[model samples]
Target: MTSFSANLGFLWADRSLPAAIRAARANGFDAVECHWPYETPVLDVKAALEETGFKMLGLNTRRGDVSKGENGLAALPEREDEARAAIDEAIDYANRTDTAAIHVMAGKASGPKAQATFLKNLDYAVTRTSRTILIEPLNRHDAPGYFLKNTTQARDIITKLAAPNLKLMFDCYHVARNEGDVLFRLQDLLPIVGHIQIASVPDRRAPDHGELHYPTVFSKIADLGWKKPIGAEYKPVSATEEGLDWMNSHLC
Candidate 1:
């Protein structure tokens, strides 16, 4: 069976967090994943987990103070301290929530100075973070001038860092837009990929409305024997549960 992670961030954009959890549990999903569950009270999320019987598949640090115009902090030279603080906070959250993975935001842009700071940050984190850290590369369109815009860049940094805990977050929608041959890339990059995500090419909607054929993609995943979560990170065109029917049928 294909285990889908209910992305509460996008799917339940309008609904309250508790309502979204109830909807997902009622839909008979195997599991659930959330985006930035840290924004709300941790105890509320814990209560939801107990009620839904959902296993948290992923977690993430902050994207900096939104009004202050900061997107990421990990790669900025001057803001290394801020990035470290974010990582620590995220680690603590994961430990508290017992979530399996964490995405480190590649904060504001920087030059060689920033790259140096990023390496230092990773090195510092490897010793502290006992759990997994997935380095996400967001699309340039959505995240203008962001430090990490593609998986290849993330792969390179992880290779240099040489930490077993550090790995790539292979988001198909962003990768399909920024680069091609995603399947082959997955084959080549499988060793370093810790998690996966999916959505439409241009619209970032449900997989059923996308140009990509998940049947082929899911088959490839089965063949690869990737024993991890493939995050369903897309906006639903209609009711969230209705949108997932197509994916459920195809995954089987």
Candidate 2:
């Protein structure tokens, strides 16, 4: 059977992080991940995970100044110091929370300088911790000007780095939007994939409502021997619990 991880970033946006973790556990999710938990006390988040007995799969580095249109710092040539600071902060938080991975956000950047900056930051990140370090390719539609835009670019970075801990964060929704062949990409990149996420294409809502058929996708995932819990990173149309029939239907 395939396992699912609730992404608290979208699923329970109104609740506290600790409460969201507990909610995910109560809702039958196998694990939980978050976007940013820096504001929450690490010990509080840790206690919730301990109490619920659910693994915290991953979390992302702080997107610098959302108001300023800064999505990430690592790829910006001028913000190298802030980028490393964000990486260090994520590592510390992950260590304290017993999280399994960190998705390093590349923000809005382009050109060789941006790629060089990203590679430098990634090297710094991988050497600091043994935990998996992931880089995701956000779709141009959702994240216009985002540095990493496709799996090929992400895969090439992983291969060039050659760091066992550095891996791709294969977000199916983004992949479908950017490149239509989701299953083929998943198969080709499985070896370097650290985590997988899903949502409805274009709408970014619950996976069950999407253009992609998750049952087929999930079956393909199982066939490919991906044993980890897939991340459900979609925004709910109503109460998160109400939209979870998709999970039940898939599991059955």
Candidate 3:
């Protein structure tokens, strides 16, 4: 049976990180992941995971200077120092929390310079630790200027880097939006995929609410031999707990 990871970044976002972790456990999620949890104390997060026995699956490097519309630092050519700092911070946090992966955000950038910067930052990240390092392709609709725009780009970078620890974060919603044929893409990229996340395409809400029927998607994933807990990275339309009929129906 396939398991699920509650993406605390969106689900139970109104609660504290630790509280969200506990809530995920109470709600039957098998694991958890987050976007950025730098503001929360590491011990508190660790305690919650220990208390709940739910593995903290992954987290992302800080998006530098959000006020300036900076989504991430890794791919910004002139901000190499800040990008490396974010990587270091993420590594420290991941180690402290026993997290399995880190999504190194590429920020809003393009062209050769940005690609070089991202490659450099990714090299730095992989060398620092053996943990899986992920690069996700954000759809243009949600992140217009994001450096990583599609799986092909991400795959090319990963292939060039040739780091065993480096891998792709294949988010089904983004794939549907940016490339279409989500199942074909998932099959083609499964070897390089480190983690998988899902949400309703176009709407970014719970999987059951949109065009992509997750039961079919999940079935394809299982047939492909993917055993890790797929991340539920969607914005809840109502209180998170109230909208869990999707999980129950799908899991059954």
What lDDT tens digits, residue by residue, belong to model 2 across residues 75-121?
A: 99989999999999999999999899999999999999999999999
Candidate 1 lDDT, 1-252, residue by residue in tens: 566777788877677766777777887665677767766777777788889888777877788888988876788877877899998988887888777888888776857887788788878777787788888887778877788877778888999989999988898888887786778888888999988888877789877656777778877887899866578899887878767776667553
State how far residue 89 of model 3 sits from its true place (Å). Answer: 0.2
Candidate 3: regions farther than 4 A off: none
Q: Pick the candidate with the highest lDDT.
A: 3
Candidate 1 weakest lDDT stretch, 10 residues = 243-252
Rank candidates, lDDT, best first: 3, 2, 1
Alpha-carbon local distance difference test for all models: 0.79, 0.94, 0.95
Q: How well does candidate 3 score on lDDT at residue 210?
A: 74
What TM-score does model 2 achieve against the real structure?
Answer: 0.98
* Stretches of model 2 off by over 4 angstroms after superposition: none
Candidate 1 lDDT (Cα, 0 to 1): 0.79
lDDT pick, better of 1 and 2: 2
The C-alpha local distance difference test score for the whole of candidate 2 amounts to: 0.94
